[model samples]
Target: MIEKKITLVPIGDIDDSLLEYISQSIKTTFNLNTHLIPCQDLIGCVPEPVFGGRYNSTTLLKQFHECLPGKIFKLVAITDLDLYSPIFSCFFGEAQLGGCCALISLHRLGQEYYGLVEDKALFLSRCEKEVIHEISHLFGLLHCSDNNCIMYPSNNIIDTDVKSSSFCPSCNSLIERALV
Candidate 1:
């Protein structure tokens, strides 16, 4: 059997610290070996921004799916660019349900994006939540009804803030089974 592991791909100039934090967070959260590959260029892969300089997340996710490495059990690409889908104005991240690829954007996670003073702790917390949420989808988990669960959908930053970084009991059980 192929060893299950997660590979984080930095799709542009994301901070080294943020990438490291994400790698460690995924490792701890999923109990999976996680590592980061060298930075990748998404310039030609993604099309031009359509809605208010935000790239279509579905398109990006498709690109990720096409290029995902066979040996990597899961792959999460981190980008600083803004992302949006046809169904939503913008989103923190997107993933292929039951697939190996996921994508996240750090653009709106930072407080400075809302014109507030930068809070490193808050930003990092949001990052972790969003990353974990997307990765959960890769494990065939759907959005949870529990508002406080990490699997609960985040309509806005406030929703994300209100939710816990960990899954609810039901989701926890589901993920445990999926991991096995």
Candidate 2:
């Protein structure tokens, strides 16, 4: 498999602190070099309005491809803007299953979204789980059966909480073999 640098593309007013935290987590989780590129610099990838106050992730993915760096650097877009796919009611994120270029949204990850007290700790935890999950897909790892695994599919914030930020042993082996 061709391994590449991971790039985090910031979209739509994402906080710098959170992006920094995500960058650190990406390094720690994948043991790979990561870079950041502000979406303000990427032309033609502007967010498009869609149904129910959501942005289309599929379109954003296409934009990611348009500016895809040479040699498959495995770019993932990070945004606070709410995202939705045609197939789902909404998405915390969407990624190519074993392909390059993924996206994640911080919209529904916060307690504030559910009309509860804001919690940075909880928000950050959920964010890391998501970043790891999408990046795992970029690495060609499938949804894991083990609920505790980071690769396990999460349908909602609760499921994201239930899964550990670390990949399970099975996934660890796969990542090692796949990336190392």
Name the best candidate (by TM-score).
1
- lDDT by residue for model 1 (80-164), tens: 8898888654489998899988888999999999999999999999999999999999999999989999999988999999999
Q: What is the lDDT of residue 14 in candidate 2?
A: 84
Query: On a 0 to 1 TM-score scale, where does candidate 2 land against the true structure?
Result: 0.91
Candidate 2 lDDT at 17 equals: 93
lDDT assessment of candidate 1 = 0.86
Which runs of model 1 end up more than 4 angstroms from their true locations? 39-46, 88-90
lDDT by residue for model 2 (87-110), tens: 644479888877888999999999
Give the clashing residue pairs of candidate 1, or none.
Answer: none
lDDT of each: 0.86, 0.84
In model 2, which regions exceed 4 Å deviation? 1-3, 69-72, 88-90
Q: What clash pairs does model 2 have?
A: none
Best by lDDT: 1
